[model samples]
Target: MTVTASARAASPLLDLVRPARPTHVVDVGANPIDGDPPYRGMLAAGLCRVTGFEPQPDALDELKRRKGPHETYLPDALGDGGTHTLHVAATSGMTSLFRPDTNRLGLFNGFSEWGRVREEVQISTRRLDDVEEVDAFDLLKIDIQGAELMVFEGGRRKLAEAVAVHTEVSFVPLYENQPVFGDVDQELRGQGFIPHAFAAVKRWPIAPVVFGGDFRQARHQLLEADVVYVRDFGHPESMTDEQLKQLALVAHHVYDSTDLAYHCLSQLSLRGLAVPDAPNRFLAVLGSANRT
Candidate 1:
């Protein structure tokens, strides 16, 4: 008997059964090009789905055109279903629901250009729960400038189904009345997620001019970072077999969490959901990557 290609591809982390439900990823405030969304990587691994929400019409058109067979792009903002003003910045990355603090912007070099508001456009938003398509997901990636809390507030129903999360966090408030990392940490903790890893740590020094005004050299201030949160990390045995697989995938590719992925494999092995040799293969791959 010949071994099928997909069955050959199946492993403890990802089982390539022909019709097994694809892992789902939901992205809010998604700019496909700018932030290098991790969901893109997951989707490329095959047998996965990605749904991205970007309010900007121009970006939405391009996203729609580039969407894959298992990917979707929605031209709507994620929020609590109400009207809000989007402060469009001279530098598009700074666009957000909250206004930039001019006083704070003036203190930083080149940051004034980043925070300079080019336009203000009033737009209505809706909760992710309002959309029937978002029934459940394995991972949720959000990057909506400083409105991370609002996205979670509106998508609480969908969020409950998520096993892991990756979102941008600010150590200090860049926008007026924006909640800092503390609020986001508390919120995710309340929702049953534990901080697992930190990525893209950005720092801004209090006095940049001292070191030739190059903020990169001055790592005095922790400005922003992307944090990875996992559900049921303390108790992997609590997760379903499918959830374990999803967590393993994200941890392996995005977080480089070899141990956590191994733990998930071990749990799956105990439940007989995965092959006995999965953990060994996983460790070997991790070791190979580290060597290079």
Candidate 2:
């Protein structure tokens, strides 16, 4: 499936933009039932059959303990879908599907900059293409830190099998010398995926204001949230160009304040830029909007 720029402008995620509802979802980097994993919002949305993959011992355990019949927990990393050495951070749960390096930390604003604690583990990897006769996915969310590119490469078959994808595209290099946005963008586009870059929030105060009184702070455009890739299936193409522009405008406007800011900052920081507001609040808004 391929997402068009027109569809991205107006729709929520690519899955939401499609004419049909997404029933099946695969959430990678799912927040642990005990510790923080990732993508808690997707689970709350009541997706049918979720398969979460985590490499951290504690987080993986929590995932297993909480996984019901509708959910499956895997302790392996999604690599080029084969056996590969995983660099388990001294912090454990911060395991990277690819080798750890300093450049990636730059993209994430030093989030994983603990400088690789002296501990390491050899974890197995699985390629999505290796799996036989798997069901189609409605939505696939991946946030494997710097390992996103590897997973995509291994999941080429699966990528074609899915309708929509929500991936964390960090321009940060996983290793000292690895390609980032430019490479992934080309790869995804080549695979017939339309990519939507998440936006960032603009600076605005949070003080409550009276509705019809003297409201000084009307919500202005803040940020872009997630870059969604939609396949060409199920999108309405007969809309006017003006309608498409409006749709894109509204879609960008919908990202939550803080989360959008965080996404924006993550993208910009790679180039050594700063966001105008509180990073926490910025990420929070985008996170909330993605939920909505």
Candidate 3:
């Protein structure tokens, strides 16, 4: 799912009005396997400046060539500034910092061979607190396969600057000893990042078998999902107008979070910083789209 900038540019859904100040992002494990990453949308709108991290050499090279003026890709993985082995898989998307829980994964269909680790490469890991390019960022987007918690563990202090986090979380232990959804939720709550919304969920059938149009009986099991965490939603007044505006753009453009967009728009409007006619129109578009 390689996303070209041109293809994304064609989609004005994310080209919502830019904020007064740039929305900064600290993206960890920013491998572009999951289609065009949200940072691209934020970048195109000139609403964000991103400092991304990716250890995969090929992916890093590709990013290096295509990175925009507001983007920077570091070839370091986020961790305790130590040497770690990457569990490379048969497919690039399944690679992770943790070993695969092959037994549990083999119970499913397309996911059975997802964690076929082909190689293990030693890599250097650095903590986000040590990075000079990042003073603070509004969003902290991470997708380091199963090591999402480890990154946060290493940079708990730095996370205080983040208002929102969009990260991948496994509902089951797809990888051995990996933190599950509960673990992630607890950690984020401890950091003051409340569960905002689920951007995506990857599920597999309960059992691999032919069904005679009895899909409801077959049932499905949750595998992994992209989870969104946000700072106190009740305390929007604590945020400046520009920060609220940046959050609004991120909510609408990156997450397609119309509800959050409405919240931000409301706050901005109350402070006389509305984005022209965005609040009402965003609601209208969402209403019409969901109706069908």
Candidate 4:
């Protein structure tokens, strides 16, 4: 469920941890092919600001057309600051820097058709650190198909201050030379983040076979997922007070992980950084929300 202003208002715990400025979010591959983003609630509630990058012309136009006051959309391809050929797939969401691996995709249902390259465009890319408009942000939400590692490699300095990251990790390589989940995990962990939870998981059945007459339903074969990671929460001493506050807000508002939010509050209280009853009030707020 998208967390609304009423939800934020009801949570006295959120009030205690709310930062002076809105949470800043940097979205790479900000195409609207998918429905509302995970941070939609925070965006609607005026609790966050979004700076989105989409190189696809049609996608960029759509984003600009519906952009809100707190949103900024840019038409820049983000990578390792080098020119590369973008494989524009039949499905916009499938488009990526790497070409589709037809052999692997043919093994699954409906993927080969969708991953077919409709066009190939050569584009110059910008590194995240080189972008003058992009500064320190609280959250990083990226889904650039198979090129996520390029962003991470080029933006280490920019990501140092980030409190949380929501990224699409693939268990199976859908694109040629794609870095799978393990690769992304190692990089994120090196940057001081621990895997928190998966927001969504996708599965696909093998081609020429249907499960109970349903092609969409798969009993096994995990394909991809949107994984949420946060700055190492176990060590409160490593995070600043502001980082704790931002993380608490993202946990509660974006991911609905109230326990994680409460943990942040408890750590704050331990350091005399928050009210003594902050954690208790958070539980009370959660209880009230559940009842209603």
lDDT of 3 by residue, 1-292 (tens): 1334563363333334345445688888787887887667557756568888888889899988988877889888787778888899887888888887788767766555667888999887777777776776789989887888877877787787677899898877878888888888888888877887888877666545536755323346777888888876688866766667667766776787778878877777677665567678667767776798
Q: Per-prediction TM-score, please? A: 0.88, 0.56, 0.79, 0.94
TM-score head-to-head 1 vs 3, winner: 1
Range of the 10 consecutive residues with the lowest summed lDDT in candidate 3: 10-19
Q: Per-residue CA lDDT of candidate 1, range 182-221, in tens?
A: 9999999988899988867877756336466555465467
Query: Number of clashes in model 2?
Result: 38
lDDT of candidates 1 onward, in order: 0.76, 0.51, 0.75, 0.89
**lDDT, candidate 1, at 165:** 87
Error of 2 at 225 (Å): 8.1
Q: Is candidate 1 or candidate 4 better by TM-score?
A: 4
Q: State in Å the error of residue 197, model 4.
A: 0.3
Question: What is the C-alpha lDDT profile of model 4 across 1-292, one tens digit per residue?
Answer: 2335775674455577756566899999998677899999888877778999999999999899999888999999999999999999999999999999999889888888999999999999999989999877999999999899899889999888899999999999988899999999999999999999999999989787998888778978899999999999988889988889899998988999988999999998888888899999888877887799
Candidate 2 residue-wise lDDT, 1-292, digit = tens: 2334553443343332232332456766775432432334433333235667776668888778877655776666666755656666665545665566654443332335544746655666777666553355555777665666777787877676564567665543545545466776777776666765453222222234333454334354221123666543224243222222223222233222233323433333333333334344444645677799
Error of 4 at 129 (Å): 1.4
Q: CA lDDT of 150 in candidate 3?
A: 79
- The 10-residue segment of model 1 with minimum total lDDT is 10-19
Considering TM-score, which of the candidate structures 3 and 4 is the better prediction for this target? Answer: 4
| TM-score: model 1 vs. ground truth | 0.88
